[model samples]
Target: MQHFICTGGCDGESSTPGVCQAEDCKKEGEALTPCNCEDGLHGEVVEKKDEDED
Candidate 1:
């Protein structure tokens, strides 16, 4: 199967079947954030950003 990716900070479909490694990308069905498909066969690593307090 193929999984999609969310290049922007939103929860979208994945082209590949795997978890998103983008620090900003939140897991599907969870929250919205900047995320992309895993880079390599291994999982991806993303830098966690702090939420702004309004």
Candidate 2:
């Protein structure tokens, strides 16, 4: 599985890595992409992958 996390005001996390999607910083609609966990209100997005997906 996958999900998004707000990285704007976040401190560095000691977890799986995620890329920058600064474009995802808009909060008025559904996520720009499917299964994309985005908090547009904040300029950040992270993908939380399931360990079982392998």
Candidate 2 C-alpha lDDT tens digits along 1-54: 334443332323222335434544432222232233244332234445335422
Candidate 1: residue 48 lDDT (0-100): 51
Candidate lDDT values, in order: 0.42, 0.35
Candidate 1 global lDDT: 0.42
Candidate No. with top lDDT: 1
Per-model TM values vs. the true structure: 0.25, 0.18
Candidate 2, clashing residue pairs? Answer: 4-37
Off by over 4 Å in 1: 1-3, 7-14, 28-54
lDDT of 1 by residue, 18-43 (tens): 54555654443442333344553212
RMSD of 2: 13.1
